[model samples]
Target chain A: MKNRLKVLRAERDWTQAELAAALKVSRQTINAIEKGKFDPSLPLAFKAARLFELSIEDIFQDEVTP
Target chain B: MKERTTEAGDFTACNVKNNVRLLSWVFAWVVTLVLADKAELYEWHSSAFISIAAIVINAAIGLGVIVVFMRHLKGLDELQRKIQLDALALSMGVGLVGSFTYSLLVTAKFVIDAEVTDIILLMTLTYVVGVIVGQVRYR
Candidate 1:
């Protein structure tokens, strides 16, 4: 999965830690998500969407597996 | 970005503190054991009392360390909690299997006396493995 978390966070002038605090997650988690090192769970994705005032589809996209 | 850096720094500091506490406890215990052994404390008439006192002291120290560590962990976010839980579960599973295998080996006379140090080492290894598993899985 790919997400516009970095862009959204940047637009909001929010650091990963701030976003993580709002979402009740660790800064490392936010960093990993932004770096595409880890994929967030469905609930986490929804939380991020809600925080950004955007739909989940707008924030994240699924990669098709061949 | 600043906040992220601070949080990351805090996490690193906390990890370092935890390692220090663990190392200190191990060192204290080893030193006490060695001193007692050399002094022939076990052969003393009040050896039982001294042994009991030592056990109590160790327990208190261990409890204090665990409590401090847990208090720090309590403030963790959802992702942190999930990672911790996953790690703990892995540790428990691995520790159980390792202990059971050791017990089986003992029963079959395949191994000699298994000391407390052996069990402690096993548990430590379990935690190390758990951390490794969590890092790999979450990454």
Candidate 2:
């Protein structure tokens, strides 16, 4: 999944650590998500969307391949 | 998926630490065996005492290593935690099947005897399999 987590976090001026704390996850998880190294579970994705006050679709999109 | 950002250096360090601990355990056992042989300790009831002491010490050290590893794992991210859990589950499953198979073999008289070394080897194999499976699944 592709997500605009980095952009959202930047807009809010929140560091990965801050977002991670808000979500009750380790900072590494947020970093991995932002870098697209990992896709969060559904519940975690929803929690991230909720925390950012955005719809899940607004935050995440399916990856497109050629 | 993007590239997996594994801390290879940290992983290597952990592996090295475990190897060293294993070597130390082997050395301790060898030393105990030599002492028992030299002192003729195997001739008397003291043989059991030495054997039990060695076993207890090894078990304590093994448990200590496990505790330390678990504490380190507690610092890992969610992905790592999932990997660890999957690995542990695999280990347990493999261990159970292996143990059952050994028991069946013994019961059928396919094997004359089952020894402590056989059980240890089975456990080691289970752990190796678990680690391999975990790495593959996560990758």
Top candidate by TM-score: 1
List, residue by residue over A2-62, the lDDT tens digit for candidate 1.
8899998898888766777677666678888888877888898999888789999999988
Using Cα atoms, each model's DockQ against the true complex is: 0.31, 0.15
Ten-residue stretch with the least lDDT total in model 2 chain B: B1-10
Chain B superposition TM-score per model: 0.65, 0.58
State the displacement of the C-alpha of residue B107, model 1, in Å, after optimal TM-score superposition: 1.6
User: How high a TM-score does candidate 2 get?
Assistant: 0.53
lDDT of 2: 0.70
Worst 10-residue lDDT window for candidate 1 chain B reads B37-46
Q: What is the docking quality class of candidate 2?
A: incorrect
lDDT of 2 by residue, B88-121 (tens): 7777776778788988999999988688568767
Q: What is the lDDT of residue A25 in candidate 1?
A: 69
Could you tell me which residue pairs clash in candidate 2?
none
Best by lDDT: 1
